[model samples]
Target chain A: MTRRATWRRRISRMLLRCLPQLMPADKVDWATAMTREFDYIADDSAALAWTCGCVLTATKMRIIAMVASFTNTPHKNAITSVAVLVVTALAVTLMVVAPRTLTPAGGGMAEGGHVAFWLMYFWPVIMLISYAATTRRGHCLPSGFLLLSLICLYVMQIGTALAVGPAMDALFHAFGANVQAWDTTLKLALLVPPLLTVLQWLALNRLDRTLTVRSMRNDSFAA
Target chain B: MTRQRKASAQTVTVLVELANNSGQWLHGYAISTATGLKSGTLYPVLMRLKESGYLESRWEASPPAGRPPRHLYRITAAGLRYLAATDDDQVSTSAATR
Candidate 1:
């Protein structure tokens, strides 16, 4: 084969390899069929066009399958997942910006501010570890242990809020800032972490349930 | 009672092609060429027909040396019934317009 023809053949083979991955698992047989049929097309350009069409078909099927699965999911579970993501974004923003706002001008952070700062800093890491542990051990760990872990995370968040809110309130009072409006704002702002932690727990629980149900359905179908 | 929806023009074209070759297993490429349907459109239609129990498919029992087996498709009895019903619907609609 000439170099150009050989290049076209190699590209077609590479795309054929990707066809199965683009298709849904149950429809893999169609990908295999398309690959085998490619050998019969003598014209290189036609073969390439056919291969591209197969890839498009596989992609369209995969997207349809995904949308169907998403629709199958409970609306409450979907809503909770979206809410968790949005709240987590807000919390991270607050964590990054709050320290600057809370620190007294030309001085260090308010008393006990470091406690809140470090807790907020490490909060994402803590949540990551929690998520990894829960999902990885989802089958092995007792439900009680999972609940206990979530409760502990929640308590830590609430403790941080209670501790840091008062200290920031006191610091603002000493600076003779209007305590009347600032006091309520400080308390509410501090509650975000704990609220986020609760949402995380709910989201995790919903995910776990959805996974368990899916596996059970698959098992039943297999049997 | 399950209400049957009207098939799209493309779907009707595919069904007619398959039904015309009843009892003969057709491969994807041949069907694409014969019906003048592109692979992207043809495969999904075939999949939907299979899912709806109007078509059946299988791997070729034996393939040429140095080549993998191709998939083959055939229309089912249900598919013929569906095609006939569609033809009747078209005939009645055309008569009504006249």
Candidate 2:
């Protein structure tokens, strides 16, 4: 392959990687739409710039959204709230203690850390899939569920990246380790929060309308 | 059907563009270029308008060989009615005496 094509391939692979997760479930249609547009663009430089901008924007958005969601709307129910807290506590403990404390033990702790890692990884993926499916099927109830879950994932990712990249980079560099190798990966992971917030905000507003209509139908039937 | 709310500037831009070439099936990218809205903003606005019954969209019958089929959007009857109603309201409210 030519040098420009190689670099463009790398740019597409590295930067737009987390786009699937950053994109809300319902907006997955736009994902397909954008991929085509990106491909159809004549200028490689413009495409690279757009891809990089998307990554940067997505990451910044998630941090702000997580804070807002936490401050404004905590939970719909006590049980789910408590359940989330317990699972989160368990995951954090596994992620922190599992690798260092039990590396000698090997599989179990390492695998536990992996599980914790994938929870945040697959969390948004699952919500996004749920949204795309439901929106296609004309199911609004699960669409709302997917929307809320995605916003949470955006927040979770922003928190994880903020905690992971810089802290780990500093820790490794202090030991004279080369942290430069991780800069690209760190950037891609860090830049995931923004895209979904716009979609999440749109969904959040319209979600109530669907819910109200469903509830009204139930009320009429009861009467 | 409920009368749609007043169009935002972005929405109006899209509408004006579509109404200017009414009945012509303009692709999303073409509309984006015409309206000067970024694809990011334009797609969401288009999707909302489509969902709100102000627009209709369909995939192109035959796309250029290399590119994927484009989605063509046009204003629906309800959409034009909304534009006309807003225009009528504007005309009635105008006054040289005032």
Model 1 TM-score, 2 decimals: 0.62
Candidate 2 lDDT over B1-98, as tens digits, reads 88646666677678777888899999866776676666556666776788789899777788889778766889999888776766644433321111
Show what share of the native A-B interface contacts model 1 retains.
Answer: 0.71
Q: Over the stretch A1-223, how does candidate 2's per-residue lDDT look in tens digits? A: 4798768867865666676455443444545555555655666666665565555444444455445545655355333443433343333433343233322322353323344455555754655474555454343433445445545654564465344434443434423443553453344334432333344445533553355445656777999
Against the true structure, whose TM-score is highest? 1
State candidate 2's TM-score: 0.47
Candidate 2, position A80, lDDT: 49
Pick out the ten consecutive residues of candidate 1 chain B with the lowest summed lDDT. B89-98
Report lDDT (Cα) of residue A61, candidate 2.
Answer: 42
- Misplaced by over 4 Å in model 1 are A89-223, B88-98
